[model samples]
Target: MTTMAATRRMGRQSWRIFSMQARRCSVAHDHTSSSDPKLTNFGYREVPENEKSKLVGNVFTNVARSYDLMNDLMSMGLHRLWKDRLVSKLHPFPGMQHLDVAGGTGDVAFRVLHAIHKAEHRAVGKLGGKSEAKNETRVHVCDINPNMLEVGKQRAHKLGLENVEDLVWMEGDAEALSLEDNSMDGYTIAFGIRNVTHIDRALKEAHRVLRRGGRFLCLELSHVSIPGFQQVYDAYSFAVIPAMGELVSGDRASYQYLVESIRKFPSQEKFAAMIADAGFQEVQYENLVGGVVAIHSGLKL
Candidate 1:
């Protein structure tokens, strides 16, 4: 079937599922409660707002070793393209300091440094100067997963990125960062924010740590807007992905939950509104690869 046809079919199925769920809920509860209904945001897991971090930590711990490989397999290397696009937009300059939250494996930080080096070289070329490149840019990678951070640090060391010394890895929570307010020039989170339970709290934390005029960048899986693509994507995500995980990482359940979480995340417009609500200004988003992923940029005023 065409992509449009697949999308229409999925829409009908979704409506049917919703109707069935509503009927079940109505039958279970004839009377309304004054208290709020228990909610499971994404991944179909029941969790309190306060417990999301721990739950997410468990997920990272389970998949840290296979995380990078799975990313390559699942996105067919398109994630690297997305990251490269994010780096291009970042336009990192020399001496700029960055904080990468939930930046497990340091991919974003490494890319930021690469961008800075490129910018420095470009400036040198303009000056008609012959100067040895110096690594002075700084970035900190903060995550709740120590093992993931360790893997990133080891990779950095292997690359002889001595500036990796400047890349501090801290076991930290995104919702409650320990960094000082208005201290960072840039902030980034890749495929990490959705795992956060209290996304608003994390956004607030990002705003607090960012200086005035600082940029906040997030790259994540997003709801695909194209017709017919959803069915193909859903089939791959639900069936092929878990099988790949089992074959590659020996973990199917974690990948299953990961896919479910992506489906459960808020739509692009809803997420942009949340960013604006968290005190960010001039929020904008760019859809990549037909909206399979998106990069959202916001500025702190």
Candidate 2:
């Protein structure tokens, strides 16, 4: 049991490990999977609907070790900022429970935990705050890929965040979360909802698992709609992105699929409507980086 003083002493400097890992992503180049034809887009190419998850799973398995690095390289480190924005808006309080779906890297969980720590410490005005573990502000990080969950587990330990339980490192799908209905105080899936085969089903699952007043927050790449900026962003995403993936992950095809999937995603307005359809209320979204990405949030009212 680390004291708040000791934990605080460990310092926020540790948070930069994620950044360093990202920076470590090789600028060097290399080149690299997939399923069915029932018909889904595997990066602009249609494939069996059932095949998409398997194909996406393979992409993650191949790059799990370098996933953070690739994220850094691809987003030029902006991903960290976007995640930070998500956590800040969450405003997680002590003893609040959260579920970070498809965020197996512990990225979103860590931020919420950190925010809780900061808040509690501020309230107490000391280093070693009382354990909230009994009613801890817990976050269950769930993902379909074992490799990705393993990486998330490793990151959680590296950050000295193992005080929680196995619920923290769970294996589950977005479309059918294993968690009980109305069990969590918050639900978040950053840059992951679009990958689901039935995003509507996933949205409903999100709504189902969250307690009344719980919020569903998602951060994803959005279609750049501004005329001039859209052209430039499109060129970069279609051309420079996969090329960057080749350099960083030695897997151009996987990255190409990622970029193409973003293009396949619905516009913000339509997506917000889906959330509403899924039974979430007060739905809204905000564009970031000139519409390169957006954060959509709703309440399970």
Question: What TM-score does prediction 1 earn?
Answer: 0.85
List the pairs of residues colliding in candidate 1: 3-227, 3-228
Q: What would the TM-scores of all predictions be?
A: 0.85, 0.83
Per-residue C-alpha lDDT of model 1 across residues 164-265, encoded as one tens digit per residue: 555677889898998999999899999998888667778999999999999999998877756556556676677777898989999888888887777666
Query: After superposing candidate 2, which stretches have Cα over 4 Å from the reference?
Result: 1-38, 126-134, 165-167
RMSD of each: 5.8, 11.6
lDDT of 2 by residue, 79-153 (tens): 898899998888887777899999988888888878877777776655465655435667788999999989988
Q: What TM-score does candidate 2 get on C-alpha atoms?
A: 0.83
Task: State residue 69's C-alpha deviation in candidate 2, in Å.
Answer: 0.9
lDDT of 2 at 73: 63
